[model samples]
Target: MNRNIKFDNLRGFSMILIVMGHFIGTTHFTQTYFDFAYTLIYLFDLPLLIFISGYFSKDNPESSIKAFRTIFIPYLIFNTFWIIFIYLTKGYVPADMYLVPGFGLWYLLSLYLWRAFLPTATKIKHIFVISFILAMLIGTVNIDPNFLSISRTLCYFPIFLFGFYFKNLEEKFTIKRSYALLILIPLLIGATLLYLPFNSTILILKYAYASLHMGNLKGMVLRLLFILISMIIIILLNNIMPSKKTFLTKIGKNSMSVYILQFYFVFTIPDIMNYLGFNYVFNSTFLCIFYVIIATALVCFILSRDKVNKIMDILIIRVTKILMKKTTP
Candidate 1:
């Protein structure tokens, strides 16, 4: 029906999938199964997040400025904190890496860029098709991934554009939700049968095709396929999902917190689980799957709490506000 709950549910669920993806990759499980499971989750998780974000995107200067204050500032803070954290904990000198994004924080920068540029981008004719072409062709270049997050910015921009366009598309056309499932079911089955070689890094989208040792033409084809599939999955799931307030609703509402804090869990949770006898107990693939889900749910629950969100808002958003106010000219 007419409710935000559906979007929140999707966001919450996708966010959990994001965390579970991290868990399954790192936690000891049958290597074969984990790879497949990770591949399956990643096929659409980040796309879903991007789509949902674009669904709410505004084409205005005010919102763009706000994105800088809210998102870019936090991104900078996150990078700085990580630099310090790594040096202190691992004795790694991340020299002159200030402009680079750290791990999950790239999404923050991407979002800021989208807010800033997508408004102007929307003015271009056939921007959607152009975005797809750019997303595919950009991988053939020799640009570094972290240099202003350039590669990923181009790679994922199509999905972001689709998200922004979908809102208007739906308003004008009556979409048949049933048809989406008809296609999605067979689409998933065939994809699963293919069992493409996937890892967390590929989904992160920071590497060039050359970096991954993939032929440029072949990599472009694969990128196109993945983008198409992700678009389908994002559309179908949003249409089919129940629009009701539930466990995931709260998490969705606070999904940003879960996203930002998840790296902490991703890196440490496996070790903690191992020390607490997780790896010793969950031997089978299914059992490890169960454990990872439970662990991710618990972490999501904790991070979704109001207190945690407020503290993060203070650390990220509030701090940004303070900085912005001081620098306002």
Candidate 2:
């Protein structure tokens, strides 16, 4: 299978947005801007990440084992770390507001689940079509929010299947400029409607059963539309600013490490700046941007180091190997 450097770079960029969205979410920003930023992030962030993940799938036992080690193991390790970190910081563990309840590690957990189901999902013709319809139907009914696992799984599983299907139909659709505009225009329209007063009724109905604010018919339409737009923009950007070397590609390769560690900067730096009485200046939107950029660069630099990453990878491998052996025997 041919690796698309373009898609890989786009995936890295999407991760940056995920980090930025989280940062903004934690900060005190204007409600309108915050909502807009969040809508944009939700529109395509995880879907694109999942789609890119599916793009790397191969039908081999070695790749499957690597997936278990690289994806599933890190997911479990990080969830445990998050639990411990929260427990130590606070007297008690709170509900997982980061992604979903009890599963603050939703990103990793969902990806692991989706990947595990890929073998079965791929065999079905029109898997995405079926999943998408079900997602919309479930979104419309207003299910109980307490069943968060079921709600999120229903909402996201379709997109996961969409990505898997996209990988299967890679050559069927051309990434054309016209298709890009077609997707972008509808996305903008849908997003605009979401902020309108008329959308309140639909929004209320949608949120009744799911913590997901964007599960309604209108919202899902916009979400998928934005995913299409994101793909188009990524393709266009890739064509315009084509990388001649493998530098960005290498960075893209290690995006997972960048992702898991980014939270340290997102959550910690703002508090630290406030403590130092630098919050007055550093709390500005511009400063937030600067801090995030610098912090991301610093993180990328640290993770890109051969010695540090090698040690981290070795530890992860050893831990996963032990876990696997214990589970198997």
- Please give each candidate's TM-score: 0.89, 0.74
Quote the lDDT for 97 in model 1: 63
Return the lDDT, model 1, position 263: 84
Off by over 4 Å in 1: 1-3, 28-30, 171-179, 195-202, 274-287, 326-329
Every candidate's lDDT: 0.80, 0.59
Clashing pairs in 2: 143-209
- The deviation in Å at residue 206 for candidate 1 is 2.6
Model 2 Cα lDDT, one tens digit per residue, 88-145: 7566665653334333356665666666667767678888777666555665665554
Name the weakest run of 10 consecutive residues (lDDT summed) in model 1.
192-201
Model 1 C-alpha lDDT per residue in residues 46-149, reported as the tens digit of each score:
99998888888898767777788878888888788878767876789676566677777888888999888877887889988998888888888877788878
Displacement of residue 93 (Cα, Å) in model 1 is: 3.8
